[model samples]
Structures are given as structure tokens and as C-alpha cells.
Target: MPKAKVGRKKAVLSGNHYTSRRFDVVAVGASAGGFHAIAELLGPLPANFTGSILVVQHLDPARKSLLADLLLRHTALHVKQAEHGEIMLPGVVYIAPPDEHMLAGPGKIQLAHTHLVRFSRPSIDLLFESVAGMYGSRSVGVILSGTLKDGSAGIRAIKEAGGVTLAQDPAEAEFKSMPQAAVATGCVDYTLPLNKLGITLKNLYEAGSPKSYG
Candidate 1:
């Protein structure tokens, strides 16, 4: 993969299809020990957060997802499992449904149950890729605690699209594989602990400040 350059050309999608920068979508991915980690990350954001949040979590399709319900206790953001064709809105968190791929484009969300990527339906790459495709630099990709490399490529795609990418610090991750893989790609812009991510993201939204590692 090529190193991302600022203001570079937008990536091409299917024949002549291109995306415009919408800049307020946040895409997050995790697996294994995701529930608590995700909650912690979202906990600090105020009810008035100005960005839309989308998440892809590894789950058994046979079991019903309680993630949206779980997160409702943590953040003031309106949380729900994604519904096909619903408009993406700020301050709302959309959870990818089990056994389905969740994709987003300008003003719309699409769900597909056709196939899996990396042996996982609702692949992190699919969500991050679509968000990066549509939002460009205005997008944010977060890879948290998990047991595989599911989110690595997606963060890279986000970086190449001029979006910001964050990985949970491996030292702080309950399961380090996913965040470690994402960091190894050198595309991630921040390797932050879960406690700091929400506040940092809030700073990004409020001031457009360039984040610095300590």
C-alpha cells in the first residue's frame, strides 16, 4: 500500500464512482473483548457529540446482538443496530447487525448478507472502507481490543483517504492482536488508551487540533 499524502487524489471506486468528503463519520471496529472497551471509548462523549458513529463488532450470527443495548448505558448518544437505508445522523451510534455487512455512503446506510470478508460477516474492513470512501478526511477509524487483524487494512484505507485512524494501545488492550496489527501498518495516526480516545476525539471535533503523542 502506498503512503498516504495530504490532499492527494480521491480513491476510485466502481466505474466513475467517487465519494465526496462528509467529514463527520466515525467508524470503529473490535472483537473478542469488545463490549467493555467500546463502552469505555464512547462513555466520555457528550450527548451532543457532532459526529455519527458506526461500529462493526465480531459476533455470532446465531445469537442476537445486545451491543446497542449494552452501549445505551454508557453514552448519551442515541444507539441502535443499523437499519438498511436509514439516514446517518450525528450523535447517533449505529451497530452493524449480526451476519450482515454494513456500508455507508452519502445520506444512506446499506446492509448486505451475501458474503463474508476474512471469514467474518460485518467485517471491520467493509465498514471502515465504505466510511473512508464516503467521508474522506472527515472520517475517523478506530481499531480497539480484538483477537485478529480484522481492522488493520481498514485503518490503512482510512489513512490513504486522508482520514484519521486510531488504534488502542496494545499495552492497554484486553486482547492486543487487532490493535497491534493496526499499529504495525504504520497508518494509524494515534495509538491511544481507551480512556483517552473519546476525549481526544472530542478535541478533534471541537477544535480540529492535530493530536500529538506523549
Candidate 2:
């Protein structure tokens, strides 16, 4: 993908003028050993976080996922399995349903029953690519603990689209291959420990205008 030009204007403006949040959407991808890492990452975010969080964690299609329920224990934000055509909301955490590819549109969520990529049905690359396409500079992509390089291309797509990209520090990841691969792409802007991700995201979301944040 070619590098997308960063727009000078804000992609979205909230009803409240007092907020200076820059990004509109945050996309996270993980696989093996991701549950604990995700829980830790989401634990510190304030309930009023200004961006919507969309997650794609590899799961077994044969069984129903309890990701939302499990994550609810870790964060104050409302957590649920994303449904097709639902409007994306600030401060909510949406998890991709098992076997479905979750995609972000202008202001809505989309689900596709497409073939798997990288041997994963809910491909992280697909979700991040769609997010990059829809939100451009007003998006964030994160790669967490996992076994494979599923998020590498997706993170690069986000960077190419002028979005911020973050990767968990491989040294701290229970399954380092995923984060390591993302960092190796040379696209990630931050390589942080899991414990710091939530606070960093909070700071990023509460930052000034787009230019100021960039």
C-alpha cells in the first residue's frame, strides 16, 4: 500500500467542544496468549475514553466466544461482540465475533463471512486495513501478544495510511512472535510493555488537535 497523506482537518468532532481528542478509532489484534495481555491493556483506560476500541483476537469458530464477558472484568468500558451495521461509539470496546471478519466503515461496524487470511478467519490484517481506509490518520493500530505474524501487514497498512501504530514490547509478551513481527516491519511507532498501553492510549486520546498529537 502507498503512504496516505495525513489530512490537516479533524476526521470527527464530538458534540462537546471541550474535548480535544484526535483519534476516532483504535484497532487491536492478537492471537495466542492474548487474553491476559488484552485484559491488562484495557484495565487502565478511563471510562470516558474518547475513541472506540475494536479488537480481533483469533478464536475457535466451533465454540462461542466469551471475550466480551471476560474483558468486562478488566475495564469500565462497555464490552460486547460487534454486530454488523452497528454505529461505532466512543469509549466502547467491540470484539470481533468468532469466524467473522470485523471491518470498520465510516461510522459503522461491518462483519464479513469471508475466507480466512493467514489461516485465521478474523484476520487482523483485514480489520486494520479497513480501519486505515476508513479513518486514515484518525485511527490507531496495536499488535499484542500472539504466536504468528498476523498483524505485521495490518500495522504497516495503518502506518501507510498515516495512522499511529503500537506494538507490545516482545520481551514482555507471553507470545512474542506477533509483536516482534510487527516491530520488524519498521512501521510501529511505539513498542511498550502491556502495563503501559492503556495509559499511553489515554494520553493519546486526550491529546490536543490532530497536528498537536502528530
TM-score of each: 0.86, 0.87
Q: Alpha carbon lDDT of residue 101, candidate 1? A: 96
Candidate 1, residue 23: how far the Cα is off, in Å: 3.3
lDDT of 1 by residue, 64-145 (tens): 9999998999988999999999988878899999999999877678999978799889999999999888878888999999
57-164 per-residue lDDT for model 2 (tens digits): 999999999999999999999999999999888888999999999999978899999988999989999999999998888889989999889989999999999888
lDDT of 1 at 125: 92
Residue 72 of model 1, lDDT score: 99
